[model samples]
Target: MRIPSLKLLQGFEAAARHGNFSRAADELCLSQSAISHQVQQLEQQLGQPLFRRVGRGVELTVAGEVLQQSVRRALDNLQGGLGRIAGYMDPGLVVLVCPAALAQGWLQPRLAELRRALPQLSLLLSTDESARFVDEIDVDIVIADRPLQQPDVMERRWLRDGWLMAAAPELAQRLAALPPERQPSEAGLLCLEDGFTDARAGELFRAHLAGFRRVGIYDDARLLLDAALRGEGLACLPKLLAAEALADGRLQAVAGYPAVDGAQYWLARIQGQPRAAIVAEVYAWLARQTEEA
Candidate 1:
């Protein structure tokens, strides 16, 4: 029997892990349809149905579950082997992966502190949200909104963030003066599209202020913040990301709106890989940063 390609197996593994094609595609940095097609090809080659559509998501069939277990094991073995070798090859080099907003709004500003804490360690930071430990690439650590649930990864909740609906001071003043029951028809809603920064923007808007019109969708927190600063629209943004703007009066919190619970940031490291002393030092420093945050 001909063996399926590694890409096909990888796609199948990601889909099975996420149980949703779109999420799997996000993790693997592939288009949703591409992941779907790859999984379909794998099923065709195996001559068995792997996934059953359940509403908008998917459920694994018995065969799919069996295949998933095996696929996970096989991929884990390969990743572990490569990680072990890579760990020893560059013991002082540490790689960290996280969303761009986190890197920009949080980590970048604190780089000097990290460098001072681990003066001997070399740091490489990747802002790609798709970067994870399971792939063949070298990623020693990750800071993500979601906890790393893979058995081979160790995670610590780095920080809990909150989001506030905010707008430019002028806009906030206008909205605040409106009658209690009057909706702010002059302002439009701004949100992130496929946002990884704080994945609850839409939910927050829907739960608290669904009457507002959605006028703009961006893929970056900075863009949303910029739009709000320009008086283009109101946006729900991480408190930390907008702290400077709010303080300087470029943006102001929407009157009477409470902060929404944002996703927790996790500091995670891959397990079973060689742990250098520098890695431990860096991890400790990161934990301290969270404590201070």
Candidate 2:
């Protein structure tokens, strides 16, 4: 059998999800009768009753449920494919992907310099750490813990980074008054959720910060950094992320919890990609920041 039109499928899915034809029509900016007409077309084409009418709304039949799942998945995949195509069509665009914490600490401060360096190129920033492969068609450059194996990409060690334990100045001072053994327990701890940080936070805490109580576990390093700034508790995070705050004296390094060494990152970029000269200049600027830091 031939497939039905996308318009009909869209109407059916929205109506099924909302369980109210009027609400679905409102969401789609169509009249209630238009949605009902689309549903009728779909039901007639399939020769089945997709929904059962109730007092003021509707409920999906088994067939409707099955179709809804498949339609939702197909539409989502279609949207993703379209987005990728759009990226390819933009010639002046340069996509850069890095960890959120790295972006917050390193890129956020240096955006003006980057814009000055690449005045003609449109820089697209993505904070998804999983997009760290230069070979990914959507990503042109990445700051990653390890280098991509593809020969078409070139990589350099940006910096050797590690976890740094710090707290607000007042909190650090208060903790300093306590004995070394009691400092961690007295101050408590704030950190990223398990597997979020580059190092294994729980294991590191057990090995170094025994008897410490966790005050908060955040999914984002930025949030954890904010918590530390608010004097919520001592925060353990990537050194590169906390370095700026520490240098400026907004955050003070807590003694006895020296940095750990497994958080190094490498900068990788695809060779001869779109706008090579501009990308090269931007990449060089980024590398220079690591040296200055």
Candidate 3:
């Protein structure tokens, strides 16, 4: 018997999995007619009617069901084997996902250390605010606020802390001249807009600045820090990101106020999967770095 086309099998698998040609087409980025054609070709090659028409849709026949299971298992095994080989051959490719702010303020600065520590490793980083892991994309690690919901994933807490009110030294000095109650209102306030809802902001504003006015809302911590440095206003920022500034006397924490307990950062991986040497090394390094920072 002649070998059937792998592409045709893939099309059929997608259609069977979704139970809809339109959905399969959308996923494969092909026209519905094209997907239907491929399925037709696949059925022709197999010399069997794979699908039975039923009220605006199609259901898999008994042969089709058997073929679908075999195809799925074969494809999964093929992909898994390829991934294992790739992981062995190119162990350096570490795909990571993190929040944008964490990527910029925390990860970027220490990436050089990571590179030096794992010289053979290459980094591919992406930002996903919502926890969405693409299994096929080969993401080995993720630095996120919460654990991934996917089964068989393990999460390790890297940093569990909160936000503190910070202001430039000069701005602090100026605020010191005003009455304690009026200092926040008289001074500028730099707000981090990312991951904040209107209700959360309102609550935070009410708690932190009962009488203070919001001068600016910034999406980036770096920008907020810059504004604070220029004596713009006080900014509420993660202690991890603002640690250096706080230590350098460039920014001082507003004393006598309660700090907000933000979500912790987690390093995640597939539970049963053996960690690649480089991935293991990087994870350890990140843990140490966060601890020291």
Candidate 4:
């Protein structure tokens, strides 16, 4: 059997995948007319119509559908093989997605140690606020709050518990000075944005505190901590972000308040891919950091 022209096969494959000559042409960097001509030539050679015009787009014929399935599988196998070869040669390119606050307060300081440990590895970090890590972004690892289990991804609980709490030395003093019945009403309160509270920090203030004035609401934890430091009011902050402040006497834990549960951080990887060496190293580093923290 004679093999078809590679260019024509490529054009047909792209057109079939995209279902439009214009899109296929864009992918191949060819004009739409050129892609159409190539597909027509291939169909003529095969003595069959591969696609049928349907409204504004084309739909694959039975033969075209079969060819498309084969082409998709071939492309996937080729990509996987190339990735494996690249990994073998370098094993250094690691892409990670982490929460913005963690990336700023916790992970940034420790990155030097990671680089020292894996001198050859290149790190690419992306910030993701969403609990669900999108696989389409092509990250090697994602650090996020544990969500319901996702298929084809391995989830490991990095931090067992964490929480958001409002605290400051001055506010603590004020609260201590206030009478028991009036303290909750007069105490300054800082609230984080609604999304953060819902995902990580359960609604604790509604149950514990009485009517209170909103001092401020902030999006970034670091900024919130700064406000707390400035005595702008009590800011609800993550324990990890406020740990240093608490130690240095800039902040104090509010007494008689129920302990808020810490948000569990998770490390996730798509199942079945060979773990990149750098990703494994970073994961270990994060685990150690959590343990030390």
Best by lDDT: 2
RMSD of each: 16.8, 8.0, 11.6, 10.1
Q: Which scores better on TM-score, 2 or 3?
A: 2
- Order the numbered candidates by TM-score, best leading: 2, 3, 1, 4
lDDT of 1 by residue, 118-185 (tens): 77777878887787663224777888888779777778898777777788888888888874246457
Task: Note the Cα lDDT for every prediction shown.
Answer: 0.78, 0.82, 0.75, 0.72
Candidate 3 lands at a TM-score of 0.60
Top model by TM-score, which number? 2
* Model 1 misplaced stretches (Cα beyond 4 Å): 1-92, 134-137, 178-183, 194-203, 247-249, 272-275
Give the per-residue Cα lDDT of candidate 4 at 74: 77
Better of 1 and 2 by lDDT: 2
Q: Please write out the lDDT profile of model 4 over residues 1-293, one tens digit for every residue.
A: 56687788889999998999999999999999999999889888888899999987899999999878987787788879998667545468777888777776567766788889888877777786553553523676788866537777776778654554546787778776765457657556676675244643555655654455676777776788788778776566777767667777888766555667666788776665436656666666776765775
CA lDDT of 220 in candidate 2? Answer: 79
25: Cα error in model 2, Å: 28
Candidate 2: regions farther than 4 A off = 1-92, 135-137, 195-204, 272-275
Between which residue pairs do clashes occur in model 4?
A: 161-262, 162-261, 162-262, 162-263, 163-262
Poorest lDDT segment (10 consecutive residues) of candidate 3: 194-203
Residue 266 error, candidate 4, Å: 1.5
lDDT of 3 by residue, 1-293 (tens): 77678889899999999888998999999999999999999888889999888776778999999999999999999999998777545657777887766676667767888888888888878885554562434677788776676777767778865777778887776775666577766686677776255333456666656666778888776777678778788777777677667776888887656656766788876665435667766667877866785
For candidate 1, which ten residues in a row score worst on lDDT?
194-203
Worst 10 residues of 4 by lDDT: 129-138
